[model samples]
Target chain A: MHREDFPMLKKDIIYFDNGATTLKPQCVIDSVVEYMTNHTSNIHRGDYDAAVITNKLYDNVRNIVSSFVNCDSREVIYTSGATQSLNMVVFGYMKKHLKKGDEVLLNKAEHASNILPWIILSKQIGIVIKYVPLDNNYELTLENIKRCVTFKTKVISLAQITNVIGDVRDVYNIGKFCHENNILFNVDGAQSVPHMRVDFKNCYMDFLSFSGHKMCGPTGVGILVGRYELLEDMDPLCYGGGMNSYFEENGDYELKSIPTRFEAGTTPIAQVIGLGEAIKYLMKIGMDNIHEHEMKLKQYLLDKVKDIPNIIVYNTSSNSGIFAFNIDGVFAQDTSIYLNSYNIYVRAGNHCAKELKDEINIKNTVRVSMYFYNNYNDVDRLVDALRNSKDIFKIVL
Target chain B: MDNDLRREIIMDNYNDPMNKGLIDDNSYLKTRTSSESCIDDLSFMMKIENNIIEDIRFDGEACAISTSATSIMIRILIGKTVDEAKKILNNYKNMIEEKDYDKNLLGELAVYDSISKQPNRKNCALLPNRAINNMLEELNKKNN
Candidate 1:
């Protein structure tokens, strides 16, 4: 665990809310601060020293992202976050290509960012939205997806790893299936890319969306990597000076190509530069090593919590480090409050996966999502706190 | 903070809440409310006869504070007139906001007197009050 890299770890608290966002590493913060302090200038416009430095640092992130996610640099589109990226995919591309009555396959475990835009699209056009059911383990396997697919299934969009269940979907197999069937594949990498190696080319993904903040970078910057051909077909959700080549008074204009066209406005320049540094940081640490560490930590937490009888643990078999649980008779918020009293931070609620109740039969849960920075001490602290949750009301009251 | 009194009242009311179920009566007015941030979803029903709060009931899943507070609230409002209930609500809101209020009027409701300190739980403490206040507004509109 690279705990020392994150200044937040020095605080007397155990943060297990990585599903929401991870704590930023010092290098990422320093990079952003350095840009704001020393070399602050608008990108791709000026030839001054500050502007040159800014443009180089900002533009170079495309290569960094391409290498990080294994996609062409020309295909990388800077966005506000995964939410905006997803919106661009659904409204910008899918709206035009997918006609009325065409079906899109989704699952209940998907976060709202992945589901809501499609729902809006279904309402606007007449596209049919179908949900593939999760198996007994609350997982979406390729078999389940296959059962839900029809000839009209034009698209299959899913999170590579679900935020709540933390179960990894076989997107590679699903992508291959889509490729053969000529169906479009959109991967919500918000919960996947940061923790593991995601090869966009190998997976045959047409679209991939991920936020920088989730991977220990700054907020307000995200990456959307689309297949080059599809990116050429996609439209920018925004329009401004940065993305245009030339314009005429009669509204006749030429926009830039592929990725540049999609990133229309003045982008979050500092955050993007910081995100590049964060990607390099994660690369140095090794995605496989980060993933392996998380799995081990998840297993350790599962084993340690076994002795606590009244604790109702959910998704014990999830491949990722997200652990959802509740003290049998206690409310999730009460547990969260009780834990907060002890400096243990966990997320408590629907977690924006509102439709997940159909699968889990519960509306709310206390989620403890981890990053590689987490260690055994954090789990021990959590178990110790949970073991005394009987005295929860004592602290909460 | 009245820790002892608050703890005792909360435990008793939460374990076995008063008026914790809805009636099948057609005359009563009901409304359901849920918190967007937390899991405090509760439904409230009130029967007002001749400007008096004849009876009230609530049913659903909520945190201990929400359940216990609603339990205490329904118990207090059962036999009170509509005007009296409004006064109680006003005073309760005042207390929740950490403003000057008559605490004797709150009785068991004062258990959440210090809830303002736990700013995050203020909504949890007031979720029931919000729903009941809606019922009050509807009743007031009908009466006018």
Candidate 2:
């Protein structure tokens, strides 16, 4: 809706790889620049004016994130990205609670960041990692989760919106189920939080993780919001200077409280401040409006591409703005290259979810993901590019 | 035509790759490789008898650049000695990287000379060659 806010849009590029990361808005950029240029000092350690301002701005971001996700600021923890946030949960909580023979149910289509940590923990601790079976469309439903759950199921981890399939899962319902069954609900909001408004308190999520870069903020910053009791019980994934309240001479240490306890050493102060600005920017535009715009653009693109011949679409029915497809007899990377010749950008390959190779029975596919800045003209450009690329197969074969 | 994106020779070989099947014989030394950036997954199989390349085959899914480069590679490696095949693979890589190389030795792989300018497709052109080098290394270790 506010394309002008992103300076990258002014360039001659039609970026459709928003699922990988979104273009940063000018307000986010300006905020980061302002921090770097004027308020350039470490937080929580210095007594200088810049340092105090930095510390105040840095700590206040937690409240911004808390209000954004409808969670308590004390529960907000800063991480490197969603990857680190997920690692903290697996290593911090699940590693301790899940025992041998305890099962953790996950979706087959979850991103690698969501699946790999659990897999590593399962291997290390002898916990059983199981998948909630998908229906024929390679889609998961609450019914599938109900069918998969057992008495031994200790945790349920899934992406609120899967990166590849773009399925907007009924995570609220699933979270309620987890609460009733005493199972920990971990939501990988890497794909969903930026696109939709998340009510962390109402969703019954024990933990929620999302990255800043995916929502018009800078990279290397993410949020991990957990229930206060759960976070208090969870061990710190990292240990260092600022995270501890006191330390003994013989190597004993009393850690700080939640949020600060998890965020050890120096944090990405500028990026986190920029993330706060990004959240405000999104809120100003209204998240519902942004979501409605994406759905409209998705429907428009789908309507245009549906008539293209010799195409295999994996998830056209997805309400989210991800279109995964492959042209018949053409490799996904080749199609991506052909599109690149037209100044179009799209993601191709298994998309880093290697375990999904067996479930979907397809090696690779091209993904065209959209964001709020994208419109029908970009979709038209992609359609024209695809139509023109048909000649490459003809010339080659 | 985007000359950098698609060359006629690349397309021809990609559409009709040579030696594009795996060897069933257990005697063939095999190794697989994939590019981290692109979807270029390939396996190279070679049957070297007394240091001479008796047979060579490649079988895997890859991008057009990789498939075509691999097809051209099989043609040059089928009848050469092990050391000679290694030399040719090395020279082909040097050529792709825009290094000094004997043009006559590269054969049809010389078409990949422009790949040096296209940085992203460089891995696509190198996937099968790297697999070949890896397979040779494994074979040498076994014989030693």
Candidate 3:
């Protein structure tokens, strides 16, 4: 819909790898460039013109994030990306609170970022990592989660929308369930936050993690929003100059409060500024519009390929814009290569969900993940390339 | 190299691979290699007697580049001594890395000359070659 907002549209490419990272809008890019070119100074320390500008931009991002996610600004913490955010949740918070044998419910559809931290935590503490089985459509239903829930299930951690399957998990209902059951709810919003409106307060989430790059912001920035009380208990995974309030030679140091304490040292000021711009850009166009456009695109692509005998789609019933498919005998990478020949970029292979192989029964699939910027022409090009995939080998070599 | 010729080389080697299965023999040293990113998990088995690679076989799910490259690699390394195979694999590595490699030495492996352009696929083309190369290096170490 807002295709013109993205500068990459000027290029001769059809980018369908938004599941990995979205194309940055001109406004987002300009924000970063402007920050670097003009106000190239460290945030929060200086009272000078540049520092004031940078600090205002950086600090105000918390409000932007809070407004976007419907969280308190005090609850927002900045990290490298979703991976780091999830790590802080597991190591910083869960490791301290979760006792041995406490079960954390997860699914195979989650990206490694969400799963690996808990797996590592399981190794550290005697936490039991349990996989809530996916349904026949490979969707994680609340019913399956309910069945897996035991008294020992201390946490229910999941992606709001899976990367490969693109199933929009009912985080609202699941969050309510967790709230009622007195379980900690951690939502990996890496796939969800970019596409839809996620009400962190209303969802009753204890923690939420998401990246900036996947939402048209620059890399090296992400938001980690924890509940206010939980933020007080959570220790910083990283510690240095900015986060500390006082230090003495007697091996004693006092750290800052809630969110700032978690954000140790110099944060990605430019990236944070870029992220704020990205969020503002997104809100202007509206989240509901983005989601609706993606669903429409998904259905359009599905209906077009349903008749093609050799084309096998994995997630026809999935709720998002992701399309996982392959030509009958072609390898996922091979299909991706063929599509690249037509200047259409898509992700291929395990897609960082290595455990998904056991559930889907196939090791790899070419994934075409759409964003709001993608239009009908992009899909038509992909379809045309798929139709002419007999020459895949010819081009791939 | 013509694009059609390259396609034929890859497709031919992929469709009908050489010694495409591992034997349950005690003498054959085998190793399974796969990327956590891609789906290719090939078990490469080798039998070496007095420094010569008597047999080499591989079996797994892989893309055309990986399968075809592995097949062609097996054909090239079989019956060659450990040292010779090392030299050939070094040349193949050189070629894959876009370093100065002997043009005539590669023969059929020359089809992947353009693989460096698609750097992402370089791992796929080099997977089995690297495994077999490591085996040869180990054999060289033990024998020397």
DockQ of each: 0.77, 0.58, 0.73
Tens digits of per-residue lDDT, candidate 2, A1-397, equal: 7888889999888999999999999999999999999989987899999999888888888999988999999999999999999999999988877799999998789899988998898789999989888777777899999998999999999989888888888888999999999999999999898998888999899999999999999999999999999987899878888999999999987988877988888999999999999999988887788888889998888888778898888887777888889999899987887787778889998887777777778879999988889988899999888777668654332
Question: What lDDT does model 3 reach?
Answer: 0.91
Candidate achieving the largest DockQ: 1
Instruction: List residue ranges in candidate 2 displaced over 4 A.
Output: A393-397, B1-8, B23-26
Candidate with better DockQ, 1 vs 2: 1
lDDT of model 2 at position A149: 90
What would the per-residue lDDT of candidate 1 be over residues B1-144, giving only the tens digit for each residue? 568877999989999999888889879888998976677899989999988888889898888999999999998988898789988998999999888899889888988888888898888888888988999898878779
lDDT of 2 at A118: 86
Which pairs of residues clash in candidate 1, taking residues 3 or more apart in a chain or in different chains? none
- Candidate 3 C-alpha lDDT tens digits along B92-129: 99999999999787889999888999888899989988
What TM-score does each model's chain B reach against the true chain B?
A: 0.94, 0.91, 0.94
What's model 2's lDDT at A137?
A: 73
Ranking by DockQ: 1, 3, 2
True contacts kept of each: 0.89, 0.72, 0.89
**C-alpha lDDT of all candidate models, in order:** 0.91, 0.87, 0.91
